[model samples]
Target: MIGILGFVAVFAGGRWLGWAARWVWLLAWGWLLVLLLAHAPYMPPELGAFVGGEFRGWFVLGVLAALALAYRTGLRRLQGRVAPVVAEARPGAFSAVELDRYARHILLREIGGPGQKRLKAAKVLVVGAGGLGSPALLYLAASGVGVIGVIDGDAVEGSNLQRQIIHTDARIGMPKVFSADVAMKALNPFIEVRPYHRQLEEGFAAELVAEYDLVLDGTDNFDTRYLVNRVCAAAGKPLISAAITQWEGQISLYDPTHGGPCFECVFPVRPAPGMVPTCAEAGVAAPLPGVIGAMMAMEAVKHLTGAGQGLRGRLMIHDALYAETRVIGVKRRAGCAACGGG
Candidate 1:
């Protein structure tokens, strides 16, 4: 490089002047800088060596800049690998079995590990372990809700087999709550199943509703449904209620505390006697409860996990005969008696 610079400088001095001379001078200086950086040694060597003078400064600066850039690149690579480990090590995280069991849920961006944690921390009370409650209870348990409480006094019978899939022929005559408990436990041993083994009457309703974060009403009678709605409204808990008669079924999530209507707001006055018939009276289709009960369970899971939008303020109606469905918006009644006229 020095030999080349010498030749250019000689030519500039001989034939070139002014601008041409300046260009040659610039080229010479650039070549010298390249040699100092690329060929010079930055490490300590014999004192006053050839590469030790001012050129050492240039070599040292170049080495320092290279090291800084390499350090930054390495740090980014290390962080990329450490982030997943840190997230996996979060406090109170899931076990290997839990991760495996809920792999599909975790894979969903809307309902991943954090959503599953919310579900596990949730406490849900299902009123009535009959028709609608059967599938609802099974699904809630299978979804790994932390605590599930079921209240019912009715016993499983042969007639319930048509729509209530949670009970078996062998479990007939067993109290509905206990039967639900057995089924739920068998589905997921990680969850706790509390069987009330009694009716959800006036005296017990409030206390039971207060114990849970959410309530699901699947009772067969309008009186029980009204009672459960009033109790849930008083306790400031969300309620998922579903009912089916004949070939039609309807489900909704009623929560006046949030932005939705309470059950009483939608049905201010229960249908007069002989107006709204019971499932037994009207003969509900076998798959009607299963369909509605699963929908109730779906709404419950959404509410607990904060995944998708729930059925809050929306009633979902299904007609099996026509194979059609529709959703209707419902609003909270400002003067609703059940919701304290709020």
Candidate 2:
């Protein structure tokens, strides 16, 4: 090549530039020869054909990567849809079999095997630990409600010992809410118990109540009682309201949407301090709270199991000392302060 360039430079009158350009071409051609020799010193026809194939290896890798990503994303979405698991209701760390753990409950015409399992999977939040809360907590926990949340901000006073069957002398100084949780869990290890040892108020109240499937208003005070009820109504949850004072007790279930009045409709606001005396002042019969709270649990279980006619539209009142029970039919108040058109 340099000889040809030299001949051209001699003919065209530029010999020095032609020499430099020929040297560059020689160096590039030498590198190319070295590369091919190192790769395959003696390349056969079949080896050349194999190496010259299209970039399908990279294409196959890309397809596989895309498929793997798609599968991962779909699997994650399915798992998210069924999260926050409820533990299976088989008796663990206990001797009762499936048939025995629920034998008494199953005997009731309302709760069959399917209904019993539904109760096992359901979660219930009881809003107090005083009078009405005592019996409700006991029965629901004993019946194997999978999850039970007790929300209260009080202590186990000596006066509360009679009606609140779950508390004991050792727990007298403990917080009422936490004591209730320990007692309920001890009664049935199959249950998961949570304690809300604070008052349920606006802003922070709805977030806690939203986690559970149903709400039970066993609170003794009026304002907090209405708070739980209205929050449940807003969240489209089933609300079971029970109130007891003096010798009187009432139990009712409300679904805010289906044209039934909510707690706000029943009591527009907290009553004045001395307007209606509390259990302490009016002096309730010792066993009255058990009657009310137990009824509250009953209504909540029925709502969860869908076992029988729910106490959705009717309010039940009980007068134990008088031995009288009354059923009051209630309708959704059109202009209820809390739940009206909300």
TM-score, per-candidate, Cα-based: 0.72, 0.70
Model 1 spans > 4 angstroms off: 1-91
- Give the runs in model 2 whose Cα sits over 4 Å from its true position: 1-96
TM-score of candidate 1 against the unseen true structure: 0.72
- lDDT (CA) per prediction: 0.83, 0.77
Alpha-carbon RMSD of each model = 23.2, 23.3
Candidate whose TM-score is highest: 1
